[model samples]
Target: MTETFDLSALKQSLDAAPDHKNLKPLGLQTIYLGRDALTVLPDVVAAMVDATPALGPVAVLSDSTPKRYHAGDLLSFVTGCIDARHRVRNVTVGVAGHTVHADEETLAKAIRDCDGAACLVAVGSGTVSDIGKAVAAAQGIGYIIVQTANSVNGYADDRSVLLINGVKRTIPTRWADVLIVDTDVLVKAPVEMNVSGFADLIATFTAPADWYLATLLGMDDSYSPTVVGLARNQGSALLEAAPLVPQADPNALEQVAKTLTLSGISMGIAGTTAPCSGMEHAVSHLLEMATTKAGNETALHGAQVGVTTIVAALLWQRVLGEIADGGLSRVRVPGPAESQAAVLAAFHTVDPSGAMGAECWRDYERKLARWAHASERIELAKRDWPTHEGTLRHLLATPQSLVAALQSAGAPLRFADLEPSVNEADARWAVANCHLMRERFSIADMANFLGIWDDDLVDELIADAAALGSSR
Candidate 1:
């Protein structure tokens, strides 16, 4: 018999976890998810008022893009639900080009403009919600998310990915006080957006492996098998619902939305992004940086991540295959000086002024220091490769499997599928350079340090991905 996912019940269990108790008591206090979720907004707001007592005016932060349903515009649809007694202010963050970034300056401006607002209602997708969360945190105000699309997992996460000095960085932020997911609105979203959410959930197939690798190396002490297990429990169910995503099947959309939300909650429980993001996300971030630098439109974060997940899966397959074949050998790890030189050289082409290179190195340096400090654990991992090989293999999905899921979901499986299309050269560059862009340890970092992630290996992985995409 197949087990059904009851999000409310699962959340209760999570709330009782030892980790949740140890951390500051802050997260989604109420989550209303259903077809008529919007109708309950007034009740949710009233509950918020009763809880906070001194709550002031509510500021609804959103973008200029008009998200609509069969009834009408989403903004007006939402406003109609709020009680007449509540003081409400609508603020548009203003969009530019094809996307709106959750940048620091923009968030700072939002905080200043919405000053004195007691609570913020984030009324768009991931980016809007991220900005709202940051602004709320800065002003010590309550926050709620009226999710407009299931485009990304940041909707429920406590961390916001913001651009700092032109470099993308994930900083700590607060979670929403309430989350309202209206299926009527979600089903009206563009097919691509919903598919993107499915693709983001696909990262679960590979990300846990990277997190396990980090745990084995003793770099992150907060690793939790319980959290990973919670996510894995729903992995196959989400993939099974992929085909229905493009059709905007309400049930399927709700499943995807729930899985994405659970993925975020796993991160919240662990107090790190390790559970849901890994080398795959690093590749996406690198591509985002390059696209922004070229002044081109960037693909949806989950869409980019979906494609990169295949690459990361293939890399893991190759690494595990080699280990199983007894190809393990000791190689000298690069020191800080050598690693710094490589980082600068790799990023110099991306940013000639060395600003981006400097920013990357500043973060990469910490990773190197941790790697150096964990030499014993690394050695232990190398020594026990035989024992760990099966675990890695079981945790990751094949590239072909990932490609098929994306194809069924109507998501882009290759660079060509992305808007403004990332080419072969760009894809290869992202694969080769992603490890330098983030301080997190991932399979990319492992491959780089082990001297296996060279140009030839990158070409092999890219070719394999292309073959898989074409085969489907």
Candidate 2:
């Protein structure tokens, strides 16, 4: 058996790190990871219930979707464990066949159902965990996450990706007091799900560069190399373990799971998702919004993000090449009205009600305002372009390298390879307008300000990705 990850050591190191001095407290109290980690739930639950005696029953929250545990039903096993010692309220969220979205309606229903709970034990994958966190925050109760898949890193973070006005926004939700990742449970999860986690993690190659670039351009103030290194230092090991993930190798799953947990914590410490979500996540969010509007089944979030990271890497390359050839001299900033119009037009097809566009603009306008006053910062960046470019290069991985890791994991290489398959037209639309969807400044935003981001540029990036066996 692989040795358990030392959560205490990690916390101690982060607390002492200089880069995270003024950050919010890390609310996640403990993590029990490895084989048979689920067996600890009963004791943990009992303790939480005992400590919060004033609070009501323990809410074992989940979706109705059936999941396989070690030769039995996952939800049943979890509830049974907790119900043995404490009162358990099985607050199932969504219907069985339908996918649960962490939107307002679903969250409202879940919060209503989880009222008066002493502690909430979220016993499922990403979406269920997201809802549970939101409910816990709303009710001011303790939250414990029983991660069922080696899925998205959000399980170990204090935020949730929720829909706000039909657009996916990462909202500040409470963190899990305890995170349980059982290798036995993870190995039994669908191989595709595990592979999706691998794909999601590939963003580490490109996202930090985006974050650092934002800091350089004065669009953001938070950029911590120490925080970014938490997961990035494990990139080599992640790449080496990619192929083994598809084979259900327990060691590989555990390695990737630990890396993902660290990644989630990095974002939490950085106080933003910028460390791990960049241009790729914006593009994936647009595609998800499009699919949801069309009443079609959306692909796994990490699967889409993994494929999009390739495009993001290629975009970074293109932007750097342009800057090397003196493209920074022609940097242009559009007026607020012009950008607002573009945002509305881009999102009109997905949401005719214009609610999505308005919500997106509310965030995007902040970025635009920052850019409007960043002439000094932009000039400074231009003067130090060479040095900045060198730093960015180190932060970013080659598109070919990202593609190789995805391919080794038997993960989707192109948008078309995703389950339910995003079409080329939709993919192009998403890539073209990804920068308009969020306030986060990324390479795409830089390209837009440089006047090089257009249909032609997007097409070139797609062709570049095609050269690496990744494109729509």
Candidate 3:
């Protein structure tokens, strides 16, 4: 099922890029790319063990999913160099590495219990990789990431976002010594996971707007066109491979998975989240953080991002049109006094905390107010304006027909199905608290800034979106 590609043409493209001067060592050193790549794990482990001799006491981080276990069959498939003592004395396999909830303490404890392992082989997608990355980095131990699902482009980056002190924070991490992916394993994953990955990938179209916005505000350093171009190309591949997204075609899944892997690495190269995320991601992060606080559990990371990507895409299109029609030039920058009032008006439009049932609303307001005081808040809003627009556009831009296309392909695009989560209130709360999540102003905040964020509008959109989801 491999969709054939011109390998020589790709090589020519690579060659045409001109043996550019090494720009500070780009990307992960170990790339286990290509189909059936995971079958070579033992040899890879043996080689790495030979190289980094200090790498001792291997602890394996595994997932509880049936898919990962099925994928483990491939790990077990590696014919040579099996060490029982290496596994028994040093191995700490956590079935809940990422699928369930293993915090820093839990994971560290597991590794420490395993005779103080020096390396952890993480055998799954983003979550497992994050845990492995964190466990290794925090303990001065290096780890390798085995990608199980092409769900998100998090594997290639040096940053690991985890719950340290009960709050999500991104800590810098080293790259995996080996980036392994059994294409066969990825092929067996639920098609929805693949589609969600694509939706997240397509978000690259809007991220440059974020970079442009950041630069316009004189905040960030230079934005790289090369990295952006790379992201967009990967995104395009995901779409082109959309038709072949199920039952894990080696050719199709390889295209999607490799693009996804490179997308993760692209973020690593960019040294910023902008390469793979935009306002859509911020919206997802806000909901995720809120759900965590609410004691709610179990929402797939990619699903939330997928839904928000749709919304952001729609909003982005709307804003893109306005900007193109001279909205930026026409609108004058309001004075701080006027700006404050407009923002406040926007806030109250959505928040009716004065009412009896608004105790929760008032408390959230306190937090929202604190977020507003951030020094760079307005600048992020102004600069990232168009990308925020693109995020909105992602919503309307992706036709329901496409969601159906994804559905026929087995993807989930609505909120109702996001397990560990079934509440629209979380989505509503996220939209309501838009201004609080990040400094980069998203469409939710733009709705407020543009005088469209009202209880009625928010209510209608959430209800309509959820209804659309339920219908699906």
Candidate 4:
């Protein structure tokens, strides 16, 4: 049996840190992560309901698709436990015979269904949990998340990836008051989903480098070493746990789940997803947007992220090479009008309504303004290129190593390996234009500034990933 995670003890240790005192206090109270963590659901719910007696029944939120528990459906098991002691209201989303999206329409429906609830118990994977957090915030109630799969780290954070005008945007929401990561249920989930969780974590190896680079460029000032260490400190153990995930090893699953929780908390404490989301995530989001617009099934978010990580690592290497070859002295920032045209042209294929492009420009335009006035910052970075490149190199993993980790876990190595495989045209589009989709300063953006991120370099990077067996 694996040792249970002591969240209170962990939080106490974090609170004692000198660097943590100034940050916003984490509101999440308890995390029950172990073999039989699900068994405590009823007692936890009862206690929460007792605390908020002025409210109505406990609303159990889920989707229409059935999930397997030990011997029954997962939702039935959840409502049965909570309903045994308190009044229970069944709140279901995605009732329109499609996948659940954390959009305004779904949030409105959930808010209406879960009206007057004392608390909310989210009973599915990431999308359900995203909707749950948004609903609990909308309804002003306590929230508990029953994590069914070790799918994504979004569950333990205080933000939801909601669709805004057909674009994926991470909106601030409420964290779950209690998180129950039942290893028994996790081990029983689809192997791919659990493996996707393992794949999702590869971001830690490359994203911090992006965050640090953004800080160096003066585009964002939110970089924190303490918050980055919360997740990066567990890097080796995470890779060791990767192979065990496919074997359904409970102990390994527990470790990955714990790291995932830490990753989410890192984001929450830092008040930005930049510490764990960067160029790789931007590429995944663009791919998701294209597939979603085409009315085709999209791959799991983590799976796409896993494959794109290799591409991201390659981009970093390319940028480092350019900087070494004296390309830093020739940095060229684009004009706002030119960037606006490029953004609109790129997003026009996915969203002809121009709303998506307009949204992207609204963010990208800010980045452009920052770049326009950053001549001094760029000059200082040029002088400090040696130190900055060393720092970035230390934070990034080699593409070969990232591929090996995914291969060990039997996770998808290439975009084509993803379910509902992304075709070459779409993959190229996403990797080439990922930087234009968001205001986040990444290695891709740096490469663009250095004039090394054109079509030839994009094709070359994809070919390099293919050589490592991690490209479409």
lDDT of 3 by residue, 275-360 (tens): 66766676676566555544556566666776665566555555556565655444333344544444344334333342211322
| TM-scores for all predictions | 0.94, 0.97, 0.73, 0.96
RMSD of each: 2.8, 1.6, 7.0, 1.8
Q: Candidate 4 — number of clashing residue pairs? A: 0
Determine which window of 10 residues in candidate 2 has minimal summed lDDT: 463-472
At residue 424, give the lDDT of candidate 4: 89
Query: lDDT (CA) for every model shown?
Result: 0.81, 0.88, 0.57, 0.87
lDDT by residue (tens digit), candidate 4, 1-472: 2335566776787788777764556778888898878889999998998888656889999888777777778888999998789899998888555667777788889999998899999999899999999999998898999998888988888999988888888989988999898888888888888899889989989999999988887888888888888867677898888889999898888888988988888888778898889999999989988887777778989989999999999988878888899886888989888899999999998899999999999889989889777788778888878888888888899998999998988889887889978898999999999999888888899899888888998888877877787331
* Model 2 lDDT tens row, 358-439: 9999999999999988889878888878899999999989988888889999989888889989888999999999999888
Off by over 4 Å in 2: 1-3, 470-472
Displacement of the residue 462 alpha carbon in candidate 2, Å: 1.9
Q: Model 4: runs farther than 4 Å from truth?
A: 1-3, 16-18, 95-97, 470-472
lDDT of 1 by residue, 123-238 (tens): 99898898998898998888889988889888877888888766788888999888888888998888888988888888989999998888888766766767887667678788
Which candidate, 2 or 4, would have the higher lDDT against the true structure?
A: 2
Best by lDDT: 2
How does candidate 3 fare on TM-score? 0.73
Task: Order candidates by lDDT, high to low.
Answer: 2, 4, 1, 3
